[model samples]
Target: MYHRDRSPCSALAVSRSVERPRAAVLLLHGGHEYGTSAPGAWNLPAARMVPFERAVRRATKEHDVLIGRVRYRCRGWNGGRADAAHDAERALHELARVAGDVPTVLVGHSMGARAALRAAGGAHVRGVVGLAPWCPPEDSVRHLDGRHVVLLHGDRDRVTDPKASADFLARARAAGADASFVEMRGSGHAMLRRSAAWHELTTSAVTGLLGLTPLSSPFTGEGRLLSGA
Candidate 1:
């Protein structure tokens, strides 16, 4: 059974069976604006993008993972907004209450990545997976401390320059945050949709960051290239 709820700031949570013990994950979609190319544009009721929901389900099978795809108000981190960090804070609290102390992972894609860094606070989040994070505000960069963060970016990405992620890496490291950046070769913004290498690289990076075993070949395309034996 799937449970869905409309929280403040237009955020929402959809999950399947939350009674069991599992790792909790919060997926923040990149759609701060209502029109144009928002990161979460493909996140409709039906779409063939990266199976975030499926990925969440797979993670749940091993460790009680509850994925919450979040959406916030406005285009930037509105700390003043009642639904900004406070909304995520409430969600994290509720997730911990339900999952106990299984550790939480905040997975954000594109603009969602930007928000995740801002929303990452308190002592509950164990790690963060930022897929092509955009430039964060100056304040968010300075406050990142005591969190294991993993940044994944496609070398050929055109939406949010990979260099931006590189910059984020530098700032994250300077702030004493455990962070690393993995480059997906020959992949575009939608790395997961490209080929096996992208999927393997991403899954491996995230797995290593989260201390989990790498899953085999999650990609289903035919343009993958394998180099070096």
Candidate 2:
């Protein structure tokens, strides 16, 4: 129930698009490498995000929304000038054009999660959902100010530091943004375990961010806060 669309003038790859939607969800996948120009295909992130994309679409089916999965042109981000971020910027612009100022939330993993946070300052973006994000200390934490950001990081994740996410949330709150960090237990970067928990957490966060539903309580665990009133 998704359409495969490619960016004619740019390297933005839309895995699929929805029709007559009420809202939009832009998905950013993880992983990037240098020598992207030497690639034979758009091998960045491969199809690792397909399952998540479908999960988003399925989760939001009742909400009547569009889910856009982006395959970036530049597959690298290390000392790479946020190439994926630039692609996400264009992808958001195109999404706004297609969806017309709809309430939008960015959902991304790792590298894509950082891009989502970077590009979330756009006019139509209302919130972001980052899954096991890989954020450097240099990544601007101010761009996420005043936007709803829900970070789902696995406590067992060895790929991205969960502590970084916690630190980012503290910074976001200090900047007066409505943010939350759900420290997922017993799950890794892939989030293969506790499937129901992941889906529910994601759906609830998306709906609550868009004001379609009441926000979940921040009273979750020790030494952590959801950073909202």
Pick by lDDT: which candidate is best? 2
CA lDDT of every candidate: 0.58, 0.74
lDDT of 2 by residue, 81-198 (tens): 7777887998888777777778888888888899898898999899999888877777777777778888888888998899999888788767766777888888888877876677
The reply for model 2, stretches above 4 Å from the true place, is: 1-4, 8-19, 33-46, 218-229
Task: Give per-residue CA lDDT, model 1, range 16-94, as digits (tens).
Answer: 4466644567776554323322234344311322465465456446654566655454444433442344445666766
lDDT of model 2 at residue 204? 76
Error of 1 at 134 (Å): 0.9
Q: Give the TM-score of candidate 1.
A: 0.71
Clashes of 2: 0
TM-scores, one per candidate: 0.71, 0.84
Angstrom error of the Cα, residue 105, model 1: value is 0.3
Worst ten-residue run, lDDT, model 2? 220-229
